[model samples]
Target: MRLSTLVYMHKNMEKMEPLLYDVIVVGGGISGLSAAARLKQFHVKSLVIEAASIMGGRMRTHQETNLELGAQWIHGGVNANSLYNYAIQKGVLNKENKIQEDSEKGIFFYTSTGRMIDLETSQKAWEIHERIVDESENYPKGGNGVQISLKSYYEKQAKEKLKELRQVAKNKTFSGEYESDLDYDEEDLKLAMDALIIQFEAYCGDTLDEAGVAVYGTSQELPGGDVPFPSGTSSVIRELEKEIDERVMNTKVTRIEWKDDSYFISTEERPEAYRAKHVILTVPLGVLQKKSITIEPPLGVAKETAIANLRPGRISKVFLHFNEPFWIPGEGDIIFLWTKKEMEQGVKSKDWTTRVSSIHELESCPNWMVMWVSGDAAVIVDSIDDEQVLKGATRILRRFTGDPGISVPDKILRHPWLADPLTLGTWSYPSIHSKHQDYYELMRAMPSPENPRLLLAGEHVHPQYWSFMHGARLSGLEQADKIIKYMGKMKPKQNGISAAK
Candidate 1:
């Protein structure tokens, strides 16, 4: 009976559909969907093919409480403003939908010895770090464009600045200014670097080496910005999906064939030809890194070089939901743990004793803190089994709270962005050794003389805002405009041919 049932199912499989579209979008992420929505506004019929079942690509929200997994806060919302705001202007984000920005009050400071320190001292240390960065970068409060790669210049400048600062620490010079300066030795600087390594890894779920250092640019290259979140980034995605007349979710595009001035896209879920006059490739840099999709005749040398050279980063978020807040008490809450060992070795009991919170309110809520693992730390965390990662995080929290009796959280939310087949990484990070701008031209490449339909857009292409959400949104808008312009030029010709016929 089982054999007969299998035979009947195989024999009755549905036939494939050969659907052609005005434009074929290869990804369903923020950029792709945003572009598709704009295309619809231009009265262009579009098709979006996504490998995942849900939309909003990396701008993910959890199912249980709708907490954001991919992009939580509206970083730079007031300044850059989230793209979701534009969607809201067009009736996307509703009245009830809002973004929350709270202040952090419960401040704790810890040391390498696992001893809690005075909050005033930690603030002083951070202030010193900020001042040094400001001096080294020649930071302008007016926000003028000071183009320099901060990482490269700051590290180089650290030698001289640290030397001078050390003298000030010994001599007690510049009382008001030098008081906050951390009297860090060479070893202390290394410790700070290790801490930063963990911080960046948690931010982008990438490795330190894989992280990019923007060189030849001013301090503004990686200038500090506000945290921004879309009013309803996910809702905007759903709305945009509606714009595409035809969309195939859970369909992984594996190959692209170009001939006769047209593009053919094929997917594993459906064995058929999906043709398009033009193709907009919005896949993340990581997807292309995996070589998941085969391009017939291959992308040109320049484009291929850029695609192959600039690799994507692996990033993910691990969210732990506790029953109540235990350690901190107010808005804008943050806890910084000063430890000697790497984050992956697991948060030691001693390390947590030094945990300090900037937000007092955090103590009132569930004893929960979201530790962002990025760079090398991200690689380590993501590579481990889920249970092990959770246990490690729990141990860290218990140690920080000095609560050995603390129990595991009620819920654990984690996004396997690196494990995701479609999105191989969380976001793009500029490599420390390579010049990312060199590959910028490839990202901007359009199909040549014979076929001018192929185009590329993503966060990596945005030199200034490469790893940022704003960069992705901006790239989508730019590409959409280019495609629209290209189509406008073809419209008259099409009309003329019709009249002749």
Candidate 2:
């Protein structure tokens, strides 16, 4: 009766049920849901089996509001117009909001020594980030097209910039003692500056040095490109689920065994098995990495390696509700902490682990402060208690505002994607030192076998759009098209029913 008991029962799915569906989808996240919904467009019969109770795998909508647990924003803009705009057109997104494009506001610079600096220095860092991407465009050897880690590459470039900084200070006609301090070798200063930039890793979930350049290099770029959230991101999925729930099997799938002609899906909640002609695996990279579900004949080596090696972006979201807005009177952009040590060691100690205690100033939330925890900072925070996380974040806010006695947050909402069993980590990120080719290879879509029985569709599988919600949507539609083509190849069986339906 219980989920655990059913899991260990070791039932054979093939013996429980005969063919019952045209297609059975494993993992009812965005990809699975989207694929199943698209099947409806073609008047195909399908069922979705989810490990979790509800659908929308990572795109979880808060019960009370428009907030999303996993994906919060439409990262790639006009590029996302097809996917995002469709969501709006279909009433999945109520209204689209656009903010000013200039980085002039809500951008601040900090030194490794903990001194706040002007925006000019920050702009230089942004420029360097661009250079890192540009530099990665060329590669030495042919390999899997993956995003190489940018940390080392960026650190090298950052050193050059830091050297230039010192040079400028020394050349000042009225140079003071501070100029003398800037005379240190670029290597020494670069190391310090590298620590400051590690704070940005908090947004990506890995130290810059460990982050792959390949993953970040292919990002869509545009001047004043708009960033949009689903007014409430959670609602989009809720809207999507409304059309698919009638057929979704809202439970955990332990094993799927396919014999010559049909595939069998077994769930713990029910002893009955569901058989289908085809199965669409919409599981996220995180879930695949966890080995949560077993597939007969196993997924191929390429897909398995991708499932294991493609590091899920280590991201966590912390929402702090305040009684009243206190810090950054009118700022709307999120403030970042530029520090020397990486996130793991930056704001953590024995008293707080997985505590992203510093880096405040959210331009998005007028009165509320949200912490976008990534990389080591996210890992550190996941290790601690909620109370500690709350205290640590508050302390950072207080310090940033130059107000040591900042009031405690009214409510603290944290999503531990790393710790969650269903979601082992956040979306995909580049593996350590891996190249862009490797990532692209992972993104390359593959149809099932010589006949195309099984299909792979998800954000991770979408080369250019991987990691974004738009990527997930595109993969879904693409898989649907492939399925349609595959179905066309088969002639109607001489029997009573269609081969698939």
Q: Number of clashing residue pairs in every model?
A: 62, 41
Q: Supply candidate 1's per-residue lDDT for 402.
A: 65
- The C-alpha TM-scores of every prediction are 0.77, 0.80
Candidate 1 ranges beyond 4 A from true positions: 1-17, 78-84, 91-107, 131-161, 173-197, 200-205, 215-232, 331-368, 449-451, 489-501
| Candidate lDDT values, in order | 0.58, 0.61
**Of the candidates shown, which would achieve the greatest lDDT relative to the real structure?**
2
Tens digit of lDDT per residue, candidate 2, span 87-201? 6666654444545556555555433333554544445555655554456544333245444456666666666766667668767635555544542434434433554444446
lDDT of 1 by residue, 1-501 (tens): 254663354234446445668888888887788777777777777887878888778887655455567765445443234453565455754434454433243345433344554555444444445554456434432124333444444455545555665676767755555544553343444344334333433443354444343431321332223433333356556666666555667678888888766787878854445878888888888888778888886777767666665657765466666676544444324444544454444444323212222212222224445556554445566667767766766666566556666676667677777777777777765444445454456446466533447777776666655666667766676676677777773234464462110
Model 2 regions lying over 4 Å from their true place: 1-19, 63-65, 92-96, 102-104, 109-115, 118-148, 167-192, 214-216, 219-224, 270-272, 332-365, 432-449, 489-501
- For model 1, what is the error of residue 214's alpha carbon versus the real structure, in angstroms, after optimal superposition? 3.0
